[model samples]
Target chain A: MAAAPAPPLPDFEPAGLLRVRQGFDLAAVDPRSTPGFDGGKDEGERLLAAEDEELSDLQERLFAQSRSGARDAVLLVLQAMDTAGKGGIVRHVIGSVEPQGVHHKAFKAPTAEERSHGFLWRIEKELPGPGMIGVFDRSHYEDVLVQRVRGLTPPAEIEQRYGLINEFEAKIAAGGTRILKVMLHISKQEQKERLQERLDRADKHWKYNPGDVNDRAYWDDYQHAYQIALERTSTDAAPWFVVPADRKWYARIAVQQLLIGVLADIDPQWPVADFDVEREKLRLAAS
Target chain B: MAAAPAPPLPDFEPAGLLRVRQGFDLAAVDPRSTPGFDGGKDEGERLLAAEDEELSDLQERLFAQSRSGARDAVLLVLQAMDTAGKGGIVRHVIGSVEPQGVHHKAFKAPTAEERSHGFLWRIEKELPGPGMIGVFDRSHYEDVLVQRVRGLTPPAEIEQRYGLINEFEAKIAAGGTRILKVMLHISKQEQKERLQERLDRADKHWKYNPGDVNDRAYWDDYQHAYQIALERTSTDAAPWFVVPADRKWYARIAVQQLLIGVLADIDPQWPVADFDVEREKLRLAAS
Candidate 1:
């Protein structure tokens, strides 16, 4: 009573269920920047690169298992404010995957064609086939994230879309798809720093867009939209993971863990060898 | 008398060179199958799965351009016995390319890791990155095709030690990489029938391995090793593209064309905005 009850604690657990989160920070593995190369430095670099490579390799194998394990597929959705390292994750984290097995679908501003179809139609076209992985860059969630920030959708409509997403995602899950959404969370200040860095690299200038600054102006509104998105879409069938973005290495490793966890659970095995077929054939030639 | 030495036919450009090459068979494109969807209807199918969605998308864009440009990169390195489709050029024509930048890289036995470092230690290093396209299903070419054919690289060298490949590839090909290598020119009989099918899939499979029916007897030997490999080493960086044994149509299109051959000279605008000061400002704000 004397401390005025601390404003009732702000109700941080909007969904009311506390998840036991295992920390995953992909950036922790960075080789920190040792310049000189000759002996030890070279070895250190190789070792770190090798460690990253092995972990990456494991991530890839697990992803395939998850993709092909069940009748349904796994859908990874990435959502983030500008300047977050989404592209970087794709470059290093999943860089080694074969082009044929990984499906990447980017959801740009809705086109008249996309609008003619239901919100999920374009997405449906891009869904991973059985035994494949699909990634939605700036996916269906944009209906909530962008529309809300731009005042293009009413609050009531925003709520409606969220419910629709939940229903659609539930159907996907029930039908066999594993849906996991990831929102890369970078602090507004961190984003500002990233944007500036982009300006610094002349070669990277093409990646810069003036529109990003305008989006920054409404930071608070975007935050509220994100908060609501997290609250509404975080279900067991398709939970949203808010990845900490200050450290990119952590983000990638976390994504890998999620993949490993999902695939390890899915455990897709090579189809049963024909009863008569020899499983392991050996040859002694390529010397 | 009738032939005053015929000018030596200008050296015939070495094995399998003069014969027109089938760019890539296209009938394999199941327009309905999205980019990542695998058409493989077999238990032995394999591929590398990726985590980075953005990178995957960029690969598609790059592939599309690679296939379109004059200097498109469609490096075909075929390694097989007598009947493989290497010489099935006219029948396996890759029509999508604009008739320019396609190349090839062929591998021969090691001079040494060819003895020392490992089997793949050499080829593990030659992949094409980002814009330029490079294809190889049996590259780092030894581990199987050559290793199993000639009793060359000791057993232990080919066995358990074979799995140490993932790390080797992670470091090759600077960042953005897209690779697809196909094994064409198949079976000994198919080889003879095909020779009638037009001088026999070019008989170039001999250039790399030369052994013949002697090599064919070790078919099971080669297959088992290949199967194990197709199962284990197909990473995100490199995945095997198994063209159908019967039709080059399905096989060529599945490959050669996936490179996207669209852009010849990509002039990406590099941003020149002042960045250091802005970065400092953002850094201060981030605090």
Candidate 2:
């Protein structure tokens, strides 16, 4: 009998379709397009569900290997506009894995103590340990994005931060950290609808901030800042993927697939036993 | 027509059935018994699944309330011997809720810096924020359990720690934080079986430490130390619940029910909007 042909791989590889390449224009990408994914929302959900067991298994191996002195990890940095569903990605995609292997930090405004140090000081403190995945909900990029848009720091200082971030990420990558930078790209109109929904429901009122409306007024400046930051910081060592996030389900699954792919590449294996297994088994049975 | 009679509540009330009461005897409590819960393994799984939605809703409300200046929070402290399924509870019970709303800290050995300070110093830094649920995988009780049994600390200092723990818990409770302490009680036989299985499986070797066998030799000493710690520290502000953990499913569901009951008691409500609703609706529509 003839050998069976290999099955086709899933069309969820995000590197080619979503990655920010040289001279990439953010304006050219459509926020509603589900690039490289032929599936609709239902298919996206199914694919994501199918990967749950594999994700859990891979994480367990990674954790086990770490205990045996493996130095490998993945850092997923999430940057998005308000109401762009960063929290949803965290809850749906990252939360499905083993919690012990996941380290998450949400960076809010810096304290007086943090401001006393360099911008990268806090970021350095939260890097994931060996054989773990670290998630930054809003990361060092915020120093360039918001600070640039609001003029919180000087123009020269803001420009300096892009170089600092690139260097910082390169150092981390050199230490066996695979950095996946995701920018959840949502249109201005979609943001308005989301904000309106928050206003329409009483339970969601707490999520709505009046300041978001003021921030919305600076949308053009923010977008410009994001464009420049992406251009300056997107490197081979740490690249950015602008995921179309208008469809929340698609965005979630795409991110999940990206993570699964990275982990598959790493291919963490279960460590071999150091002791004589047969002898230990006999001893255990007797004991 | 009269309304139908309300359904009976599930009998897995950890507060009543498992709480370490005055004059509590750990030796008398069977580690194999399911306490008030009459459920089998399948029933326990069903009940845990049923509580997922309610747990998520209550947590969202708590998170929302916190944004509006509500100071209420819940801290679930889990103390268990090795192989008693603390990781299982974290993944199954606590992982079902919003990741953003749940703060988890797994306390391992104290670092040199942490050992330099008082025991409570490291713990204070990891406490749950207002309107969040914090889960402590292993907690300050380790000072009494491991320290006393291993003779790591002086007897006088160990005696003083019980009082210190009570006072620390009381101080936290006074600041709108509700404390729920749970001790997963697994039988010695079950522990032996678990450790044996770990040794028999090559994949599980990373989790097995030869030191665990040495620790097993002091099992009775650890038990005696635990009994004293539970009896001395079980107070109105922070009570300890000793759930039979030989059955992992039952222990998980019991812990879930305990968390749900505490959240139900708090009954966090959504905050009213500070901004004008109708005006924003129109403005959003116009935009």
Superposition-based RMSD of candidate 2 using all C-alpha atoms, in angstroms: 4.8
iRMSD values, candidates in order: 22.4, 10.0
Runs in model 1 with CA error above 4 Å? A1-72, A278-287, B1-287
lDDT of 1 by residue, B51-136 (tens): 12322343334444433332322234454544555433311232122111122234555675456765665664655533444434
Tell me the lDDT of model 2 at A171.
Answer: 95
Q: Which 10-residue window in model 2 chain A sums to the lowest lDDT?
A: A1-10
| Cα-based lDDT at residue B271, candidate 1 | 27
lDDT tens digits, residues A253-280, model 1? 5555565456555655433222221211
Q: Could you give the CAPRI-style class of model 1?
A: incorrect
TM-score of 1: 0.49
- Backbone clash pairs in model 2 (N, Cα, C under 3 Å; residues 3+ apart or in different chains), count: 0
